[model samples]
Target: MFESLGAFVDHLRAQGKLVDIDEELSPDYEVAAAVRLIDQRLGKAVLCRKVRGCGMPVVANILARRDLLRLAFASPNDPTEEYLRRIGGSLPPEVVRAAPVHEVVHDGDFDVAKLLPLLLHHEKDAARYISSGVTVSRDPQTGLRGMGIYRIQVCGPRELTISIGSPPVSDFLAKANATGKPLPVAIAIGLEPLSYFASVVPVAAGVDKFDAAGTLRGAPVPLVAARTQPVEVYAEAEIVLEGEMLPNTQREDGPVGESTGYYHAGRSWAARLTAVTHRAHPFYYALVPFAAENTLLMGVTREADLLAALRRKFPSVRRVSLTQGSVAMLAIIQAAPASKEEATAMVRAALEGSMQVKTAILVDADVDPHDLNDVQWALSTRFQADRDLLVLRDLPGSPIDPTATNRRTAKLGLDATRPADQAEAFMRIALDPAARRRVEEILARLT
Candidate 1:
């Protein structure tokens, strides 16, 4: 397990998965443009050594691909299985006396925009955003800790607006607001992969994400108390912003591009920044909203959980794929269904299990769920819309879904598995093994 984000970055550099840019770049659009170009060409994480105005360097696209996710866990095998194994248990975090985050603390005379390299990713973005800050909070009554990735809008030097959506953190803020008290919050930037993964997973209310993160790392995560808040943050985090979500207060927050590839109008609630602390010469992490890294970061853990949830109900479920291009709205399942009834049941289970999954397609175990072409082939040959289509209307849906009306939308499922009686008719054409081997040998010599 990595001790800090710096360690993870170093590991990525050693593996040739990261690139360093010595050229100066502006935080507004230049840094984001460079990241997008590199993501399209090389798909490597970038570390910009100099920014136009900021003192700290900026890093982007840290988890842009599945291979990088595997590398984060130091696992060369299946990433899903590795992720499942890591988060299967829980371990409480350990508190430490000192932390790198508190090495340089600024309680007064601080300007967030001037100090940090916040990025303006899209052309229509209202302002620079903190897209990757893992906001941490706790229940005032039960003292249950919650962590989540929230969009923080830079409104002023000490004031910011936050998007508190459907997550545990929102609930915590609500409970605190009921008491007419500002909810204490700590935003940790540049965290290790395990901590970041745990923050995004859907867990029960009152569940501590730090414990979950410790479990994923196979060791207890070290925590240090924030300088300006009661909340504790990852001791090794590169930067930590301590603040409070003001009660009965709201402001314009966005029109910023989200992971769903659309601009969401700004929310009302705002956070009052109290202190900004960081390690000396910290790395400013930037996550370009609607990018590959944004999709994978949100979808990978959800896919693993969905796979486990489906297998518990249907043993025949071999694999589950939350298609990256669909932004996690589409799910493809590879399973061996005994009959049409069983295939339909599996589809229903998948839809019921994951609220974000709007489209589900069930294929035979022979078809690769991860391969879009193979899934499409199954849909073409085995699926009959009249007999296999399952549609649910007027259901609660994701707010990001453009088709959703009044927060409700329709769900579609297709059973693409071949009929049991017509197995021979749907058999796939195969290449002779001896002839394929001979061809491979000839090609190898030619190369």
Candidate 2:
């Protein structure tokens, strides 16, 4: 695994998975447009060497492919399961004195907008947003550290609006606000793959995310205390912003595009920036909302977490996959069901395991959960509306879901596993081995 973002970039470049753009691009829309194009065509990470205003280079689409994540986990066979097992074990972070992020510190009288190459990804986006910053905060009650990826919109010279919709940051902020005290926070930007993966994991309350990150990397993550706040940040992070979320402060946040491919209109609490620290030269990471990188990073790890949870409940669950295009709203479970009841139970277990999954489908071990076509075929052939479909209404749902009414939506579960009695009827037609070999030989010769 790479120790830093720069190292990861170098790895990608060597593998021909990264593209370097020398032309100057505006952070307004040009950079985002290029990133989307790259993702659509080549699926490679882009390094914009020159931004119109900012000095640092901008990096996008780092986590655009699931294979990249597989490489990061260092597991070729079962990356998701490996990631789950790794994160399940905790390794406390090592607090160090000297760190790379402290090489250049800008305390007081610095504008965040002028410092970072924040990108305006969508047309209706209110301002340039820091879409990839991992916001770190500690619970005031238990002193448990929490980390989450939140949208930080540059609202003013030294002020930013941060969306705290996810846990346990949201819960931490609420507790701090209840005490009428500003919540101390440190935002670490441009982190390595393991730290980034751990930041997004929905760990239970009181679990330290830094430990989870370290465990994922098979080592302890080095940390350094923030210069301005009483918080710890990744020692090798490219940039660190120390600040506090002001109590009882709210601002108009988004009309910006979210992972759900819809503009989420809402207000966010403000974080007053106290200091900005970074390496002498750093790469500004840009995660475009609703894009492949953003969706993959958010969805892939979540699927792993769900899989881990489901496997504990139902050992028959062979594999689990969340559809990437759906932002993890749809979950497919490949399970070896003893009976129809077990299949239905697996579907329910999947839904309970991951709240973001609005639709859960269970198929036999023969079906590939990752293949949308395979899952759809099973749904079309084996699923019965009356007997197989289970709909749960008025369930808690994602705020970004456009179809949800009042942050609540209906969840659907389909047991698509073929019945035991009708196994032969559902068997797929296959070509004879000798006939297939003859066609392959001819195709190979033609190629």
Candidate 3:
């Protein structure tokens, strides 16, 4: 596996999965537009070497493709199962005395907006955001280190606001708030791919995230102490922002676009930057909200957990896939149900299983859950809306979802599996094995 972002970028370039633009692009919108277009059309990561004002280059859409993720796992089996297997063998992080991020330190007055090329991804965004920073902080209660990706809105030269939605950090904030003290935080930006992926894992409370990252990478992650904060950051990280989340400070955080393809504006916690550390020439990592990379990173662990839960409850569940275009709001499950009642139960379990899953489609084992076309065909032929569609009233839901009312959402499940009574009638048309093989050989030779 690649050890650092630079090494991974080099690998992407060698594999023709990355494109570099020498043209000067504005961080306001131009860089985001180009990144979205390229990712949608060719599914390539973008590296803008010349920003209009900032000196560091910007890279986005690197985690958009599953093949790239496969390279990280280096496994033939499912990534979710692989992650589950590797996570059980946790490896502790190794502390280091020196790191490249400490080579250049800004301990005094400095403007964050002037230092990094923070991108304004959406038109209605309240301010520029650092979307890809993996924030590392310790739980005040347990003293265990935790990491998560948070949107850091740059408010001023040294002030900022962070969205503390997930736990360990939120828990840390609560404990600090109770004591009228600030929680120290270190935001590490642009590390290796596995570091970011592991940070987002829904690890149990009190579990150290750096160890989870090290487990995924099959090696101990080298960590260096933050200069200004009491936290530790990945040693090979390109940049580290040392700060403290204020005890009682509140700020209007967004109108910024989120992973749900909608603008989310809310009052969030504020923080003050104490120091900024980085290498001589660091790459600024940018993530476009509502894009494949954002959704994929957010959904990877969710899908894995959902699949594991569904399987434990219903042994018939074969596969689970969170549709990428839905922003992790939709899940397609492939299963072989023993009866229509069992199928409906599985569908209901799926919808209620994950918070992000607002729509669940249950397809038969014959259909490929990952392929939308195959799932659609199954839905068209095997489903009867009146009989198979199950809708539930308002329930707890993801806050990022635009359609939710008061953070409550109505969810639905569609059982697209062929009814056992009509199995013969709904039998698929197919060619014989020998004949299909002969045709495939001829087509292969012709190609």
Candidate 4:
């Protein structure tokens, strides 16, 4: 696996998976527009060498596609499975005296707005956001470190409003607020792809997110003490913004376009930036919300978690996919069940496995869960509304879902497996082995 963002970018360039944009682009909307267009076309990540006013370059769409993820994980097979295997255990981080991120330090008075190329992702966004920075904090009570990607609005040169929506960051913030102390935080931007992916993995309480990154790296992740904050950041991170989340300080920080493809307005906790440190010549990373990268980064780990959970309950569960078009609100499970009851049970297990999943579909083992066509076919031919459709009401759901009512939403499960007794009657036709091979060989030569 690549060790640093620079190394990964270099490797991607070598593999023709990265594009260089020499034209000066504005961070207001042009950069985000280019990232969106590239993602929509399944194109390479862009390296914008010139921003209108910023000194550093901007990079976006770093890992928007499955092929890019495959490169980062160095997996010959499924990257999600590889991630699952790596996360089974963790390697502790190795602290060092100094690192490249501290090559340039600005602790006193600095203007973040004029320094970094923060992107304005959507037209309706309240302000330019540091959308890709991984917020690293330590639990005040347990002393365990945690990392999470959060929406950080640029309030001023040295001020930010962060939405502490989930745990263990929220849990840490509560403990700090209980004692009336500010929670020390270090926002690391432009980290290795694996470290960013590891941050979003739903590890259990008391588990250090840094250790998860180490596991994904297959070696200890190097760490360095922050210049101003009482926290450690990945030594190779391109930039680190050291700060503290003030206790009992609230700020109105909303109307930002979220991954759900809607504007979400809410209150947020205020943070005072103490310092900003980075490499002398750094690259600012930007992530466009509601884009492919946002969905893939959040979906893959959830799919792995759901697959593991379902398999533990039902050994017949073969594959699971968090459909991207649904923004991971829908799950498709491929499994072999002995009866209709077993299929329905598997679907329920999937929905319960992750709060993000609002709809689940269980298809026969022959169906490919990742393929929408295959899943739709199974739903059309094998499912009956009265017998196979299950609706669950008033269940807990992710608040980001705009369709949800007061954080409560209804869920659905569709069993698309063929009737067990009539399985023989529902057998699918297949091409003859010799004929198929001959046709494939001819097609290959023509291509």
For each of the candidates, the C-alpha root-mean-square deviation to the true structure, in angstroms, is 2.3, 2.8, 2.1, 2.0
Runs in model 2 deviating more than 4 A are 429-447
Q: How high is the lDDT of residue 325 in model 3?
A: 86
Tell me how candidate 1 scores on lDDT. Answer: 0.86
List ranges where model 1 is wrong by over 4 Å: 430-447
lDDT of 3 by residue, 1-447 (tens): 677889888988988899999999999999999888998998888899999898999988878877767666767777767777787667999999999989899989999888999899989998999889988899777789988898889999999999987786888898889999999999988988888788888777667887788889999999999998888888999999999999988999899988877788888899999999999999998888888988888677888889989999999888888988888889999998999999999999988878879999999888998899999899888899999999987878876787799989999999999887777898888899999999999999999
lDDT (C-alpha) at residue 388 in model 1: 97
| Model 2 lDDT tens row, 1-447 | 678999999988987889999999999999999988998899888999999988999887887887777667767866677766676788899999999999999997999888888888989887878989999989988888888999888888889999997799999999999999999999999988878877887676678887887788888988999999988889999999999999979999878877778787789999899999999999998888877877777676788878777878788888888877778789988887878888888887777656688999999887889888989899999999999998888888866688889978889999999996787888987799999999999999999
List TM-scores for all candidates, in order: 0.93, 0.91, 0.94, 0.94
lDDT tens readout by residue for model 1, 353-407: 7878899999997899989999999999999999999998877776678888886
- TM-score winner, 1 or 3: 3
Tens-digit lDDT track of model 4 for 1-447: 777898899988998899899999999899998888887885578898998988899888888887888888878768778877888687899999989999999999898887799888899998888889899999998789888998899999999999887887999999999999999999999988888788787888888877877888888888899989889888899999999999989998878988889888888999999999999888889898988889999889988988888888899888888887899889999888988778878878777767889999998888988889999999999999999998988888976788889888889999989998897899988899999999999999999
lDDT of 2 at 333: 88
- Ten residues in sequence with the least summed lDDT for candidate 1: 197-206
lDDT of 1 at 65: 84
